[model samples]
Target: MKKTITATLILISSCLLAQPVPDSPAYEHELQIGLAGVSSQSIYLGGKSQNRIFPAIDYQYKRFYFQAGDIGFNLIDSKDWEIDFGMGVNLVGDTDRGDSRLLKDLPNLSLPVSGFISAQYKSKMGLFKVKHDYEINNKHNGNSSSISYAAPIFKGQWLIMPKISYEHHSQEVVNYFYGVNTVDATLSLPAYQTGAVNNIQLSVLGLREINEKWSFVGNIQNEFYGDEISNSPIVEDDQRLSVFAGFLYKFF
Candidate 1:
């Protein structure tokens, strides 16, 4: 159930990225419900790829919004700029130990809840964003920041968006997820720690309005890891890929 919820949040986040909020929303109160699935490659050694299907829900009232497990408020809303403050579950970490025998002996890393502030700038060329997230749950007490750009293309009733992002994870975040302490180290897995690293991500999102109340959405995302992460004993891959798709019904 926990893994299902996590995957749902990830897919919801992707879908939301594809459809940015308009400066002036069409509805004062809005709700959307859907079914979504995600297939993701595992970056951990001896870890199997994960596939999950779960329900998605999103709600909005004026400047406040809730999407899946994320809740936020818009601090600034304008035609060209948007600033938001929110709390959300971090989407990138794997917490399940049952997925890999090699990881069974290690302590499980719970998903971190983070508080974030983000700013977005829209222009004719594209949308540019900068965001920062800090762990509020004391899980790792770490922080992350990202910069991204996305451009949208429209064709008839379909919208396609392509995005590229650069992300930085603090050393504490990396250590909590990938590091092996002396006590947990095994013959096959030695103690390891790595400094901060930067990662790159590329994604494309597609959405089609099936009708007034129904819509379809899909996204493909790929992440390339930094050398620090790839060199970790628990890591087996230098990259990960994820694909998600869903159909949604909107209620106003």
Candidate 2:
């Protein structure tokens, strides 16, 4: 169940804006409970495709919010611009179970908790956002940054959003997660050093409102990795694809 929850959370964080946010005054403090499913390709060598189903929860209370397993607070709330700070789990280390037989002897990587600051701008063209996260759990002691743009389209009771983003992971993060250090080196896996990794992702998010109390949400995304990560000893693919779908019920 840990793996399923981790996968669901990863998808939620990657498609942060994909989840439907009700604008009604009645939903000011909403509790959303749902069941979600994820199908994704792994980058690790010998890693098979992962498909899992899991339950999800989200809640919003004024400036404080909890989405999936992430807890955050809005430090600045405004009409055109907003800034927030909070802590959440990183996507990589947590989900990597080293499922490959080749990686059976590797040291287990623990999930890293990170503190993040995010800034967002809403304009006629689209919604633009920039966010930075630094590991605070003394895991990799690394940091990452991402910038994205999303445009929302409304058609009747359905809302669609297309998004594009670029994310950069610090060298420490790449090395810790993908690099084959002396301690992890095996006869079959040679020691490998890594640098900063960058990724480009495209996503489409959709929501269909069933009623004031219920909605259907879904997202599809493709992420392409940079050479830094793809060239790692344990990595086999340069890209990953993920899909998610769920239903959320709003409770006041």
Q: Which of the numbered candidates is closest to the native, going by highest lDDT?
A: 1
lDDT of each: 0.81, 0.79
Q: Write the per-residue lDDT of candidate 1 for residues 76-106, one digit (tens) a residue.
A: 9788998999998865557763278988899
Compared to the true structure, candidate 2 yields what TM-score? 0.93
Per-prediction TM-score to the true structure, in the order listed: 0.94, 0.93
Q: Which RMSD values do the candidates have, in order?
A: 1.8, 1.9
The TM-score obtained by model 1 is: 0.94
Inter-residue clash pairs, candidate 1: none
lDDT of 1: 0.81
Off by over 4 Å in 2: 1-4, 16-18, 21-28
